[model samples]
Target: MKIISPCRVHMGLIDMNGSVGRIDGGIGATLDYPNCEIVGKESNEIEIEFSSSISNKTAEEDLKALYNRMYTSANNILNKIGQTGISLKLKEVIPAHTGLGSGTQVSLSTGKLTSSIYGYNLDAYSIAQLTGRGGTSGIGVSGFEYGGFIVDGGHTFGRNAEKIDYKPSSASKNVKTAPLLFRHNFDWDVVLTIPKIPVEEQVADKKEVDIFKKFCPVPEIDVNRFCRLVLMKMMPAIIENNMKSFGECINEIQGLGFKGAEVQLQKSTLKNLLIHLQNISYSGLSSFGPTIYSLGDKKEIIEYSNEFFDREGLEGDIIISKGNNTGYKLI
Candidate 1:
């Protein structure tokens, strides 16, 4: 069995305050380019291999982490079904820790393939639950299940709630995938610029936890404004295919609520790049990103991103992608 899953761009987290009884609401869209593809078959013993397509270009640390996730995810599903051993091959991958939600995609894809190979049918949510993903954001899980523009309702907050504190998905394991409130086929062009940065600047593991601890419980007023923008402005623009309004919302989101804090933590070069892109079109940093995305004018955005990278003597990937209306495919 083979599974191919699309990657996603997490626009932002909404309602970090959780004052209104929910927390960790998310808005994002699935992307067509830079996806995860894996094939699995029954084997006497567990095994994993990455195709030359990925092995040649992927970083050593990223390859190690991806290998571990595949091994662990396969084991989790195998244990669940009272089965063991599968030969897995990774044909392609989304780069990790660039604010593109690569971890969730890797885990879910591995789990799903393992379950299918063992004749144990499992849905994306079930795989997510078994593999402990979608703790804080539903975009990755939902993106794997049903693609396009998505808005998740988030988890119940306060004492004895689905989530009691503000945390990223990696740190909020075992939390159920949030309820998906809205989904639409997002047709706008998406330009992604992933700038190369040092490992220390890539936020993950303990750094992500500490960042959440230090800058959470964002002001209630900011959360309220964030909600209004999503509900009134962003959603409407998508339904109407208004790129201008949608881009405006993306630009505004960068300076509001939890997203504002996330942007504050970025390096000066990334900050300047975001400002430069905003001047050209509607742009925002995806998650805790060195990955900046702009909506509309794909040609102009890609050209400028290349120029910016050249001027700064930085290196990375620039991709032109569109929303994936269909989720993962099986063959």
Candidate 2:
């Protein structure tokens, strides 16, 4: 069995105030390019192979730890379904820690492949829970399950609730999944500006957790504005396929607390690039980003990025991708 999972661009967190008892509301859309494709078969023991080299930018120990985590998660899931062993070949993978939701896409792909090959009928939601994902935001899982523009209602908040603190998925202990609040098939092309920054400069693990802890419980008014933007502007634009309105709304999202914090922590070069793009297009940072996504004419965005790189004497990967309206599939 083989599974191809689309990657997602996280827009921003809608609310973390927990004032109304829920937190981590998020918005995102799936992209057709930069996907994780896995092929697997039954075997005597757990094994995984990669089609191409894992990113040279990632450290060896970090790569080993990532593979181990995925293997262990898949092993546990397969064991629960009475399957003994499996061999997986990673036909393709998204870049890790680049704010493209690589971990969830890879994990969900592995879980789905294991379940399907062994005759288990596990939905993506169950697979997410079993694989221990979707704790922070449902957008990734929802994109894997239903693809397109997605909004998650997030988790309930309190001292003993499913989630109380703002943390990365790796540190989340809750077994609960964020609920999908809204979805729509988005028909627009996204130009991704992926900067190849040094691993040390990138934010992940402890630094990510610290950022969430320090900046969360953002002011209530900012949360309210995020809510208003999504409910009144973003959703309507998506539903009506109003590209201009959608872009306008997206341009304003980074001002919200969650992505706002990420922006503040980003490297100066990335910060400048984001500002430059904003002058000519609607662009926003993705996750804890060095990746900025712009929605507009594909050719114009590409030409603009190329010009920017030349003018600034900088280099990075630029990709043009369309929205993935359909979820993952078996091939």
Candidate 3:
């Protein structure tokens, strides 16, 4: 069996303040490129192989981490289903820690393939629970199950709530994936620019945890404004296919609530690049990004991003992708 899972761009986290008794709501869309593809077959013991092509683009440390994640997820699923093992081959993978939600896609793909090999079919949410994903944002898990523009309702907050503290997905294990509030097929063009930065410089694991601690519980006012934008502007634009309004909302989101904090935390160069893109077109940082995305004017944005990279002497990849209306495919 083979499973291909699409990558996602997490627009932002909503309601970090949690004053309204819910927190960690998120908005994001699934991308058609930079996906995770894995094939699996029954085996007496677990085995994993990576395509040689993957080495040219993915860093050595990232490959190791991917291997470990696949192995651990496969093992966990196998134990859950009372199965022994499976041989898996990774044909393609999303780049790790680039704010593309690679970790969740990889884990869910691994667990799903392992479960299928044993004739145990499970949904993304179930696999997410088994694999300890969907803790902080439901966007990744929801993207895996239902593609396109998505808004998750988030978890309950306050004392004895589903989540009491502000945390990223990695640190919030055992939390159920949030409920899906809305989903629409997004037809706008998406341009992704991933800046190649050192692993230490990128936020992940402990660094992500620390960042959350430093800037969380953002002001309630920003949270309220962010929610209004999403409800009144963003959602309506998607439904009506109003590119201008959608782009405007995307631009505004960068400076509101937890997302604003995330954008403020970017390194000077990346932060400046985000500003540069925003000036030319609508753009926002995807999660704790080195991957910044812009909506509309694909040609102009790609050309400008190349120019910016050249001017800065930076190394990275620029991709043109569209929303995937369908989630993962099984073949």
| lDDT top scorer | 3
lDDT of 2 by residue, 1-331 (tens): 8899999999998887888998887999999989988899888789987655664555777678668767976887887798888898887788887899998998889998988888888888888888888888888999998899999988888888887777777788655778888999978889999977887998998988888889988999989888998999999999888988888887787777787888988877788888878877889998888889998767877887888788777778999988998989898
| TM-score of each candidate structure, all chains considered together | 0.97, 0.96, 0.98
Q: Please, what are the lDDT tens digits per residue for candidate 1 over residues 259-288?
A: 998898998999999999999989999989
RMSD of each: 1.1, 1.5, 1.0
How many clashing pairs does model 2 include? 0
- Tens-digit lDDT track of model 3 for 1-331: 9999999999999988887899999999999998999998999999999988886777788889999999999999999999888999999998888999999999999999899878888999999999999998999999999889999999999899898888889999789999999999977779999989887788888988998888889999998899899999999999999988988988998999889988888889999999999988899999999899898688989999999999999999999988888889889
Give the lDDT of residue 220 in candidate 3. Answer: 92
Better of 2 and 3 by TM-score: 3
TM-score of 3: 0.98
TM-score of 1: 0.97
Please list the C-alpha lDDT of all candidates, in the order they appear.
0.90, 0.85, 0.91
Which residue runs of candidate 1 sit more than 4 Å off their true CA positions?
Answer: none
Can you list the residue pairs that collide in candidate 2?
Answer: none
Poorly placed runs, candidate 3 (over 4 Å): none
Candidate 1 has which clashing residue pairs, if any? none
